[model samples]
Target: MVKRKSPLRKFLFYFGLVIIASIILIPFYYMLIVSFHADYDPYKTSFNNLTLRNYAEIFGLIQSTEEAFFGDEITKRNLESINTKLERLKSISASKESYLTYVEETLIPEKEKELRNMIELIMDFSGLTPENREEYLQNAMKIGTKEYNEIMENAQIILSEGDITLLNDLYYFLNNYKSEEFLDKELAKVKEQINELEEQKQKIIAEKATEFPFLKYMKNSLMFAGLGALFSLIFAMLGGYAISRLRFRGKGMLQRSVLVVYLFGGTVIMVPLYQMAVKLGILSTPFGAGVYLIIVYIIQTLPVSLYMLGNYFRTIPYSIEEAAIIDGCTRMQTILKIIIPLSAPAIVTVYIYAFMIGWNEYLFASAFLGLKSYKDLFTLPIGLNAFSQSAHSVWGRLMAASLVSAVPIIIIFSLMEKYLTAGFTAGGVKE
Candidate 1:
């Protein structure tokens, strides 16, 4: 006998579904709103006005410059000296490689002259010559020694020292000086500057190298997701078949074991898995992280996948396999040709589920990968995390990144929703 759902019960069921749908969509809705909101403050709760400032900042269209003052001047001087040294090293290295070319080619002479002229122009603009360099050093020493002595002699004398008077003196000395001695001093200063530039360049290069991994993170993530999906689907097919068709001792137990894994909770395994990853030296490496993430996702998705496909497989009559065998088709051929085609909807469901699991995974990603600088190996989720941190809690940019991250998943699910729903429902209802 058939029974109709009570009006109140039906109303409650629809109301609950509406609530669940709203809950699922709230994050995405917030993400969209924030992405568009211009003045969304990360620090404040006040949402007074909307502005694109956060988005502009994230995209590097806007930036703040540090104001240079008297104190910063000394730091600037040191940086200039370091930069000069680095330039000299680069020139020396390049010259060493192209010594023969420099000696033989007219083009090389022209280029060298142009480079030398450019360097001289820069030095002139900065008021940095051999005389200036020497004067700067002399003033630096005098200020340090004299200031310390003055402070020690009578703390009140500190005010009497005045506002870096030595800097004015050094500037005057460079402005007035013009002799062979001055030229020699200038040449020596230029050489020192070149050496300093070389060192600064090397430091910059090292810093950039440190950030290289973050660049590759996206590529690695995509590769990992693709491979993980492929491997999981292949394995899930076999696991699903074993659970569905093969009658063996403990078959029911094996089916129930998958449910137990789901009940056990993913968080419980995180610590042990992380320890194993660290022990295996896979923590920092892309291959290790990718493989580990794949394993985690496969295990996490396996029970559901197996159960879903197993139920689908159960609906198929054994006579289909028998008829294939009568046609002289091998077991593998029969499964591939007959069974797989019939289970296309289920396979698609499992594929989508596995892909989504891989795409949205974060815990293993955060635990396995220590730094965000490994950009090359970043998945969309990891990239979004990095983008959020880079934005320094700016909600608009963070939401923008979040919105971008979700677009792919949304598109995928939207396209497969019908098939997925059908597969899920079919797996539940047996004829």
Candidate 2:
């Protein structure tokens, strides 16, 4: 027989859904509206106007200096080239004797000797023997006065090229290249400009930093939600299987125990848990804190997870497991290959629930992670609190951060809600 759902029930369900949705969306809407507001004074209740200046400032697009765009390499290369030119000028100006010696060694050797010999022959032209004169005349043109004159001319040419007047001037006045008064005036102006720009950038960065905390908090919320869902699914599947298939003693007691744990509040054991964490040195570092928090979350989430999965497992027929065994399958195989596939919706529901519990948890996070030095180790809740306390709290940026953090979770839930509901209801209905 098919049974139709009552219209009153449908109306109530939709009404409840609407209320829940509003509860979730109102804060986000408020944040989005505020993020567009330009007035930054936290004490002032009213906003002056909406502007993109705050966002631009945070991103370093507006009022940014040219220096910010340039890398260190360009500056370094310029400095190096300047230094190299300075060193070359200094070397040239340091020793005139060394410069002359270089010229003598390089340019005067072959030409000077030949030219001196030719000058001797010209002066002794009448007294020279025929053979001697012939020998002198033959070699004279090749290695004598004419050759020496040519070499001297070449040396003059080389010396003209090697003239150090420009280099000497540069070396002598390198220190005074820029006048002190001029440099000081230019430097002051540049510093003043930099200071103004830096101040503006700082203001924008401060606003954006405030927003980052809330965004981080939102991520923490999602992480916890996902973890909770996973734990819940495991518990639901295992617990359901045990109750449905096993003929164990104290089954009723076990069921009641699971319920008792679920009913147990986290506040009751907060002190002891804190002490245990301290003793174990879990409070010493961020990683330790995360470990402690995960443990606490697992303990808190286990019971409900077990109950949800156990209930789901109970709804499946025992005949299916028996049929699998008859088909030469092991119990593990039957459960993995048969039962789990059928209980997908229930598993998904448990996973989602567990994830939510972990994601939303704040009390334990705040209490246990009270130290300020380990603030980075803190979850989203702690980060949000820190953001709220900072000066120049721009509500718009905060809202932006909040929205960025939340949109993912909302999307995931919206897509999976149908499957999760189906799993939950399937576990509830048993033949």
Candidate 3:
């Protein structure tokens, strides 16, 4: 018989666990907060300033928008002034002629020569003869149905192919008129042009992010880590089963050798591993680095994975194997059908360990794949290392990158956590 824990003891144990959990989680919490807030200072925290801009910047959104909004600075500033003047006029009762006179004398002349020069430039670019310049200007000024269709068609083509600076000049020429009615009509057309340009920019932005090397690096990391984990799992399973069940000379020595290798930390073997990679001529290439890293990870993590699985295998009753053999199952078939099924939990545990080792092993990845020429081979760790070396560091962006690198590990572990507790059970069979 065993004595149950007292309620006080259980409460104390849970409280202690909570404290330790909080301690472990605080750094992650801080990192998440910093990732969303630019110029974050612990002493001056403000929730209102938290934004997704850092993430947008990382994924190429912010830069794309800026590029799309190019050539519109003067138009924006001049529009503000025009709006203010219009608002002032609204406060007073004035005849249409008075408004027109005010605009003609004050607004048009201020940028009239500038607008005319822009119009002449556009006419030359459009291959319109000088005689047709006056005709196009007349057509543009009419703000009629024919003018609308012609300008919209021509504007679309110009916007699609010409520099944005030309578009800006064209918008200013049409919209900076002295007539109130003309201003309103041209302003509407300008707004429509803005919308079309924005849509074109959106199309460009969609394809632009693929150009970012970090995205490629992330894909490479996922592929390499997955392959490494898969190979490691297989080797660990086979090595573990053989050592645990098969009779062979030097088997004990093999197990001891695994333990000895496992005891050796990564730092101790870094130099030798790099030397070996150079000797093998596997450095700097994606496939080469990937294969080398997978092998290294298997060697480094296999001992622990093997030890865990081997002990678990030893716990299964020998009678189960004997029964399988009596039923005419071969050794390989019995191990596959019986042992592996019973060892699912341990396998999952080992897989998670191996996957994490591959995914997050920064030192090896950086040393092996950290050449500027090996752009495709660069992993998240290497990307982050290079990003951090920029003269101006955006802590928010750095933290976001860190979070991106960590998410796969977090998700995999979270989903598979339940299976881990089922490993190495002694309840295989009983008589």
Candidate 4:
């Protein structure tokens, strides 16, 4: 029989654990807070000042709030001016003459201008037109049937495809300017637009998770790491099976030396690997750089993968394979249908380990993909590092990118943690 811990000891143990956990979590908390910041000012803790513009900027959505969604100063001023006049006209409950006079003089001109500017900004950002921002802004100032048609077509596309909800409402509001009931409809639409804009703003803020470059980098990373992990697992399974099952000359030496790749640090082999890549012309282009990275990742992961799976295959009872052979299964079929199924835990663990190595490898990735021509092929780690070193580097955005970069690995490790534990210790188990 075992005695339970006293209440005081229990409290202390839990209290210490809480403290340690808090310490570990503080940086993540800081990252979350700063990612919502409109600008980098750590001392400014006012809830009002926090914003999700950082995330938008990452996507290259708005160039200035660090980006915009009908949130720019000129747009804000125009909106305020029109809304004020609209309110005044509504409150007065004036006759047609008075209402028409006020609407014509104040609201219609600004609303028309607002519509034009809004469309131009929207189209420019949508990148549907070959025209640049300045060109589009200039075009936005002018209005013609051609411009209106283009705006309607492209703006429709933007509304259907884009995040901003205001464009549709704005188009409707501006269209109402042409109707006689436009005066009455104007007040209601403005209120609806304000509420809708606020809602859309909140939604965008919530999704401000990764930047545009990050998407491309993530794709590169996924391709390199994902393919590397898959092939490494395949080759490792083959090699590991041979080593564990078949008797051959120098088998013991081969088993012992399987981990020789890890004996010297990766740095020691970097020069040799670099020279090999250069000689093989694997780094000749960006696509070639990717191929090179994948090959290197396989090599990096294969030794341990082979060793782990070899041992784990040993833990799987030989009687199972014998049974498969007796049932007319081929040797390959026995390994696949029998060996692999029983060794699922070890297989998953080794695959994840291989993935982690490729996913997290920064040194070789940067070294190989660091050329200016290969910028698009830069993996997440390399891209994040470049962002941090750039002139526009902000702590908030950097932290956000770093956090996003870590998510895939965190999720994988969390899911496969049990397999990892079982696989690592399975070698010690006797049949």
Best by TM-score: 4
Q: lDDT by residue for model 1 over 1-431, one digit each (tens)? A: 99899999999999999999999989778776767763533445655566665455444454322222112243345556666656544454353234233323543345444433433443455445555544433433232454323323332333234423433334333333344464455456656766666666565444323322322444556666666766777877887787777778988887887668766676888889888877888766766676777777777776767777788788889898989899999878987998899998778878777777776677777776535345556676776666555523456656665565567777877888897667657543111
Best by lDDT: 4
| Local distance difference test, each candidate | 0.60, 0.59, 0.66, 0.71
Q: Model 2 off-target regions past 4 Å? A: 1-29, 48-221, 228-232, 418-431
lDDT per residue for candidate 2 within 10-118, as digits (tens), equals: 8999999999999997976677677677444445677767766445544445443323312224333444554565454444334544434433464345444444453
Q: Flag clash pairs in model 4.
A: 62-67, 64-67
Better of 2 and 4 by TM-score: 4
Which ranges of candidate 1 are over 4 A from the true structure? 1-27, 37-219, 371-373, 391-394, 422-431
Comparing 1 and 2 on TM-score, the stronger one: 1
True lDDT of residue 216, candidate 3 = 71
| CA lDDT, candidate 3, residue 243 | 86
lDDT of 3 at 427: 19
Off by over 4 Å in 3: 1-22, 39-48, 56-214, 415-431
Model 1 poorest ten-residue lDDT run:
63-72
What is candidate 4's TM-score against the reference? 0.61
Candidate 2 has its poorest 10 consecutive residues by lDDT at 63-72
Q: By lDDT, highest first, what's the ranking?
A: 4, 3, 1, 2
Cα error of candidate 3 at position 129, Å: 55
